[model samples]
Target: MTELDLATKAPESDAQEDSSVDSPTQSSPIMGDHEHCVTDRPAPAGQGPTGEIIKLNDIDVYISKPADYPHAPTRLLLFLTGGTGIKSVNNQIQADKYAAEGFLVLMPDMFGGETAPGGKEAYVADNSVSLLEQVKLKAVEIAKSFLIDMWLARVTEAKIMPILHKVIEAAHEEYSDAIKHGEGIYAVGYCVGGRYVLLLAKGTQEGGNDEESGMMKAGPFIKAGALAHAASVTPDDFKNLQAPLSLVCVENDALFTDEVRKVGEDLMTQDNVEHEVQVYPGVPHGFAVAGQYQESNIMDAQVTAYEQMLRWLKDH
Candidate 1:
């Protein structure tokens, strides 16, 4: 079905609670050691003193690129951070995992800073605001508020798209492309980053034009996107997605639950699109983050996820 036709589906009850009833910090241990696969790497490619900056709305946007490699794959993992933002403790671990797997990683700071206000205390805060206020202002707003969507437009504006355009352009400008396909880019996004990746796959630079055109014309910068524990974009937004897509939902993920599943399911029926949904048993939200640094089913899930993504990227 056409995307416009697909977009007409009514939005769901924003009233549904996505928070985990059972705490992840309190989960009992499982068999295998799942500590972070990556250690000693810098936090993402930027967020440091001397990383490259791409200015979007004059907001000193940071874009991290892995150091020069003779045989770098064309794939790019554009990470979108969760509540903790880009400097999150989980990022280093995931970046290391993707880099080790041979994908050139780019962790973009969608949020201006790291960590959200009130921390996890909001979960148990009783003297706090009403449930609707808590969910709207804190939960949904923190993830994909109206402003963030507005920011997407700015990224696509004449001045901003060029910056992001240059970032992707420069990557291919210097890579070998000897592995997998000669010229194809793949993406994996976690949490907020997961939703960001779909926006990326649908098209780029907010309006779904400029950056996508430039990147695609530049040398096949993106072919497919995979979202893990994505809680940002609603199913209605799935209409924007065009490239091959994969949705990963953790059994213990507090963010994107069964309601999120219905959205992904609806998108699966679209033509010329390859979509798959995988729910990892007992895995938590930010499972990739946890898997990279601790013991859990996380690593297996990530490996399986990436393998599926690569297979799709190559075939599509």
Candidate 2:
């Protein structure tokens, strides 16, 4: 794919409540210890969703249905994966956790179903290139390179939003029985995925050309949204949010810095959007989904953030 086509393929909350203080009702421990794995093992038949890879509008989507599918209705969660690319063990564990909690979770591969060459190891592989260089290279290939001027336009108009439209339509048709109770649609995104969450909430901005382009409007479908370790979000991005949002902020995230967090908060306040921004004291970005940090506090933060996301979805 060319850069533009690759770019096309690549690609919160309410309230003032402190989600950091929220604790999970049940313990959901992350898999493995420190090494992040790429291959995702299937969920045990009766424990969680029967995970499957299905085609949606020519795009491959990894779907995890609740074990008791169609027996009773449940909420639908579009679990967007982070910049590390989808098909990671970390994301699967988290999505299974959501499914275990009774959500029909749909995870789309934002990289047009492409897997990184060396899986999770490629990100941290021992090479002449430094780890930072590796990360930057991956980020560019996945998201950052396309997120320049008109970043929102490039993403919402070209990449994920169309895929989102197809997913929503397919869900209504395929899961009509399971979603009959009007449990409503909710979303959780990480890193670049988080950017997609915000775009859904805000819809098209003033000069976005969405009307002329006829892109799908997510504000009508999504009832609530949450995200962790979001990248490329700005104060101006919050202007047209139509639903409640929750933000799980990492205190030391280089991408979602304190300044950017403050701008988001300030903009939310000004816009009168129901939103929440909770700062986890010492963790770095991707702590929630990746579980890269093994410290007690960070692990606790992950559990708390997960609980908070569920709570927000239920509340809204």
- Top of the candidates by lDDT: 2
TM-score of each: 0.56, 0.69
Clashing pairs in model 2? Answer: 12-245, 12-246, 13-245, 13-246, 13-275, 14-245, 14-274, 14-275, 14-276, 15-275
Q: What RMSD value applies to candidate 1?
A: 9.6
Residue 310's lDDT in candidate 2: 79
The true-versus-predicted C-alpha distance at residue 246 of model 2, in Å, is: 1.0
Tens digits of lDDT, candidate 1, 231-258 = 5456755664567776666664335556
The list of candidate 1 runs beyond 4 A from truth reads 1-68, 71-74, 118-166, 169-182, 203-221, 252-254, 290-316
Q: Each prediction's Cα lDDT score?
A: 0.45, 0.58
- Residues 1-316, model 2: lDDT tens digits: 0000001122111101111111232222121111111222222234433477787655677787778866767778888875444456567667888887888888877656543222222222234555555455454433422332233334443556666666767777777664565456788887667777777677453333343324444354576899876765665656677768888876655456666666666766777878877877776456667334336786688789889887887777
State the lDDT at 74 in candidate 1.
Answer: 44
